[model samples]
Target: MTTLTKNKVNDLIMSQIPSFGSFQTLREEGLAFLKEKGLPAMKEEEYKFTAISKKLEQSISDFSPAGKVVLNAETVKSHLFEGFDGDIIVFNNGHFDSELSSFQDQSYELNQLSESSPENLGKIAKIEKDPFVALNTAAFEDGIYIKVGRNKQVEKPIYLLFFNQANQGQIITPRILIEAEDNAEVTFLESSISLDEEAYFCNMVTEVKVAQNAHVHYNRLQHENKKAVTVNNFETDIHRDATFTSVVVSLEGDMLRNNLTLNLLDSGCEGNMYGLYLLDGKTHVDNHTNVDHTKPHAESNELYKGILADSSRAVFNGKIFVRQDAQKTNAFQQNNNILLSENATINTKPQLEIWADDVKCSHGCTTGQLDEEALFYLQARGIGKIQAKGLLLYAFAGEVLEHIANESFRKHIDALVQTRLGSSF
Candidate 1:
């Protein structure tokens, strides 16, 4: 286990100066909590495979606090979605960029996080458990707030683009809050891009609340510089008869870690999660998801897949909890991984804890290489070796890709996947 001295952690916390609203209480509390309980060490079972202390130490040691970054509109123009006609909210170096943001109508309200009330801001998710989230709550300077009014069903999707232009040895923490009221429906898309080839750290946290009968579809795309380290945490609360769906895709980054938590707070709530990761080089990706069933008749389903090559490493840990009162709950979880290189490593675990005797729950995990017989079958039909391998991997990944509802975005992701698999030929 790696433990940092109080002086060192205090120095790290004092490195950044917040320009947003007064958050000294959160900062002080977070610093105290961090001092008492340092970063997750190797001995910690929850973070055994993807320990963060060493990497975090290095990143923090190299941290250089930066002033507000001035970005030209044309410089980030290429990062926008090609065919999506929905609203676009852009964040430049963790700060909301009003000039780059656009919305379709007044069906929803968009504001800066600093303008929101503290009760409304931090009530959705608890951050005391994770030091990363506590640090984010302490240090976040600016963020976005989105709220869909009651009975508002937005036809177009809402896009959130987080563009990072950090210099070497800098860290950016971006925060987001979303609330979907009763009977409201909306689709949200989140994508991150590292503009330069600077080695930096990006920490992000998003909190969502879905009211009764509300529906929300959320997709997060991570395509950053290979030298950058990104950590994202998502916390959501689903109310009665509400539904929440999340899809996460990680394509490029030095190290990526995601912590997703869903709370089925009321009866008839539904939660669904899906993920796809394609990693190569020395990249590392970790995904940890937790779903809590607190009421009866709630349902949750989770599926995650990974393809690792070269010396890449990946980890997936999913947990489902059914309380005693959560009778009639149904939950399912699965994880699948494909390791293309002998040096690549994957650790996956699907866990289910059911206290209610009247509930149905199941979990499974699998890790294996691509089927050689399938490759041989394709090669026998005059296909080249590389082409056959690409075909098989493509088919394996297509099962998840085909579930994407956005045709244009799905095609874009498909092309990227093909390029990664060398199937574009």
Candidate 2:
């Protein structure tokens, strides 16, 4: 085992002194875990493309509690949930804002991490291993803990909003944990927005646990400030016969990286993942996803598409793993990209590792520019070049957006994609 000096671990622990009072034990445990395992090196296959060491080298500071921000109801409605109905839970810089949050009867419980019970803490501690996860477990002051009871269906979705209004050169970490009990159905929309031009870092971790026979839909909409850096990690556990769907839409940020993992623990489980990224200027976005089939008869499907314009770049790495006992497993994955400029670049890799003999798995990825033949055909039919390109791009992205079961939400995302494509498109 790799070892870290005691003083080094203590010094790292000291950096979190401001937000380190309540969770001191958790912090020490995390420090010890890091000392034993050390940080993931560049040689680690999973972290090869993502150079997290540079990020960890930066000074670590405590994220002060941002009590609340004055936001007009109209502005909130306009920015989030333009065409959907849901219970809204707002967080300003990692702290829950009860004043701006609204909930229905007892369909769900919304509480802060600081107010969570010992039982919940035990659950969170069970999965805290990665350096970032350990860091979040060590220094997270306040966040949201949502639970949907058994046999209950949340008719309205739950919206978790994370807004960053930090000073320049500041960094914020928003940590959240959600649990859906057996036979429960729920939809969660998590958004990250910013209102300043600061170079802040929003390092967030969200852990979700889905009980047997439960259905859960989790969507992440990241539209942080153009000058900010955001790294989000989503980890999910799906039990017997459960279904979990995750969709991520990223539009703005300087450097953004998302790590998503779905673990199928029991038979007859289903997992779906979809992502859409639109980047321009000098923005860089990376999406790394993993799906693990641990039990027999599990199924998973994943599709990710990107539109890169200007001089932006995007990277996609998706992996599917089937254990030896996971017989009769079925998994499919595909990634496609469209480069709008000569300088734009896209790197995509779809991987499948199957140890079971009876599994059916297939994976493929394609990256290419817009079809000139199709563009010429449309232009020849009296369509303008800009309009023809826009139409083609819309059709290229339509397949993935069609997976959204909600009509209104689908239309909303469609419009957003069109608007982001700009007038020239």
Tens digits of per-residue lDDT for model 2 on 1-425?
11222344345445653443355676566656655565555576655655544443442232332334566566566666457777888777777778777777588777887777434552532434456566556556667778889988888778787778776534576777788899999987777878667666666888888999999998777777777777777888899999999988887787788888899999999999999888888777889999999999999999999989888888899999999999999999999999988988887889999999998999998888899999999999999888888889888887777776555566777787888774623
> Candidate 2: where is the Cα deviation over 4 Å?
1-13, 18-22, 33-44, 51-75, 118-129
- Superposed Cα deviation of residue 48, candidate 1 (Å): 1.2
**RMSD per prediction, one decimal?**
2.0, 3.3
Extract clashing residue pairs from model 1: none
List model 1 lDDT by residue over 1-425, tens digit each.
Answer: 24743456556666764644556666667666766776677688878898666676665554344445777777666766568778888888888889877786789998886776435565655667577777677667777788999999888888888888777667788889999999999998888887788777887888999999999999878889888788888999999999999988888898888999999999999999999999998889999999999999999999898899999999999999999999999999999988898999999889998889998898998899989998898899999999898988888788777756566677778888899999322
Each model's TM-score, in the order given? Answer: 0.95, 0.89
Error of 1 at 60 (Å): 3.6
Q: Score each candidate by Cα lDDT.
A: 0.82, 0.76
Instruction: Pick the TM-score winner.
Output: 1
- Summing lDDT over every window of 10 consecutive residues in candidate 1, give the lowest-scoring window: 59-68
